[model samples]
Target: MASEYVLRIPLDRHVITTQRSLAAVLEDIRRVLHDSAPRSALQGHLVAAGHQVRLIIDRPEATDELVRCLPDAGAYCPATVLVQAAGDGACLAYDSVASAISPYQDEEALAVAELFDAEVLSLLRRVAEPAPGESGQ
Candidate 1:
């Protein structure tokens, strides 16, 4: 089987009540990523399964850093974010950055990918979790 990197987060009602719609969640994710890495690019937005939205992010800056260590590693430039409304509330998923770069097995590439993974994962978690004393809209 082909290798894969995926993160799936189950949503809580408070998050759903705050973010109202998938579009809002997407916007929140986009905003968080933008804040995290302004240089990275948001490449596309897509619809899936009727009620789901996906965001495609191309981090040339991050890839550029990786390429310095392994020039042939340009294929994994863009990453994806998927959000779907479900019976519980909502689910957000994405490919794992480490899994994406692990094929190279290069120490430098793995290190960079690990850092990228941490940053993006943190961003997604922040997007899904509401702040203290703040009601979502």
Candidate 2:
């Protein structure tokens, strides 16, 4: 009923065609990200970014796959929102519940932030959301 989360990444021009479930899509991204970097290094990147932050992703294949994964029921807040496009990158704005917590507020929170942030950054730098020149195909 309400917007939950937003995800942004580099737009790839070739894979925007078709849609898939959100979980499956994110799972792909997660796998790619983990494979691309070490946990400690990703966490350090987030720490260096100064705690809370926002980002943009431009990968379309990945985004379309994520859109396909959009669950029919039971999805975590803000993590559920599809990315919004502006210029070259797309932005994911999660619901307030997702954005309100600060990684620095507590150890557990920090851990959560580290994990997600790492995933986001890894996707941003290493993976393309779709094939080149793909836009909503």
**Model 2 lDDT vs. the true structure?**
0.34
- Which residue runs of candidate 2 sit more than 4 Å off their true CA positions? 1-81, 85-99, 128-137
Clashing pairs in 1: 5-96, 18-136, 18-137
Candidate 1, residues 20-134, lDDT tens digits: the string is 3455566676565555445564334444556667666556677788788877556554666667765434567766666766666788887876776666666667766655664
- Report lDDT per candidate: 0.60, 0.34
Worst 10 residues of 2 by lDDT: 43-52
In Å, residue 92's CA in model 1 sits off its true spot by 1.0
TM-score of 2: 0.28
Residues 31-127 of candidate 2: C-alpha lDDT, one tens digit per residue: 6534433423331111113322332222233223323443210122123223333335433333321233332244444344334534544444333
